[model samples]
Target: MASHVGERMSGSIGVNILLYSFYALSYAIPGGIILIHSLGGGLLDMMFSMPMSRMQESEADYIGLMLMAEACYDPREAVGFWQRMEAAARRQGEEVPELMSTHPSNQHRIEKIQSWLPHALEKFQTSDCQGTSAFADAFRRALERGTQFQTIYM
Candidate 1:
């Protein structure tokens, strides 16, 4: 019985890694070299593709927030996480730089996350499975939105 549980757990870990790997690759293809090879960014993708990806990130964050609520996470966490991320970036202050910062200003994202909190909290109070599964679903949906062909590139 214990071995069976271990086997199931190992299988689940494999699935999660596979899911994330595919998502990263899907985003990377149109994203160009910077998305894949950390050291080989195409000039055009660097100049243009990166910023477009940032906007998509912001859009995805809000979309993710909604889906998290729908799947019953405490979406309120988005507010705090964004705020902390912003403060960290400000501290970084161009020392290292980013490839594609798809996040909006932390303050803006905090406000957006705040707007979703009440509903998310309500869902959190009602749901089962601790909400991680819902987050995984939201991730899959966002990855589904990425493509080899495209729309609002930025």
Candidate 2:
């Protein structure tokens, strides 16, 4: 929402006027210098934003895991999900270095999920909900058959 507001504001006439003025002022700059400046600015933005994005992704994973467990779904499946994702990424050659990516590696997510599993399991165990829903049973069967859960979406 904040980003949407910022975008809208930047497109307003006053902001666009200021932006155009700056562009006019910089019009005499050499194309090579402008390209280098643009690249450097982009690199700096990535350096600052990527780590924050990755951290937020990991935090979301943790929260989702806990929420699912609290709602009586098995937390162990979280680790399995990451493992499957890692396998898919490897097969597609989609893996990126952690420092350059906006999300943690699947293996890293798996390890973090495993570390948090015990607590999530406790939440599941203490919850009033039963653990044997149709979906849960089906998921377990799929895992037993070595089926990719990605094909079995809700």
Candidate 3:
């Protein structure tokens, strides 16, 4: 049992590393282009780079969602997470037009996540892992607490 758990942990770690590496590469490519075009800094460079940065951010979110679903997490929780993010952004007055920002607008992210959810649910259903693990349950509870806190404060 211990060995099985260890193997699962190792696999999860490997998956996390791969996902993070992919995210870094995705960020670096657009960042490099921006750097080259800007030759340090400029408004035009920022204008060109914003779209690419937003695209990369959306891509990362998609990939991360898929990874979590593949790992047997409840992908529906992602919707709540994004809702919290949107709320936080609104509270901080950081909400911006989608095209002008480096990240997708919260609404865009929520829509994207919703659209991808059916596929994620299929993956989760087919996975051998049964129900949420203790850790995931704990995490979900924590997230719920956070959401509740946000609702109360913001």
The candidate scoring highest on TM-score is: 2
List, in order, the clash count of every candidate structure. Answer: 2, 0, 0
**Where does model 1 exceed 4 Å of error?**
1-55, 70-72, 95-102, 129-154
Estimate, for each residue in 42-151, the C-alpha lDDT of model 1 and write its tens digit. 54345554555555655677677767766755677777787788889789883234554434556766776787677667776667845577777888888778742356
Q: Report the CA-based lDDT of candidate 3 relative to the real structure.
A: 0.74
Would you list the rank order by TM-score, best first?
2, 3, 1
Which tens-of-lDDT digit does each residue in 88-134 have in candidate 3?
99999988887667788999999999999998888877876654576
Q: Give the Å error, residue 73, model 3.
A: 1.0
| Clash pairs (backbone) in predicted model 1 | 52-154, 54-102
TM-score quality measure for candidate 3: 0.57
Best lDDT goes to which candidate?
2
The runs of at least 3 residues in candidate 2 whose Cα sits more than 4 Å from the true structure, single-residue gaps closed, are 1-36, 131-154
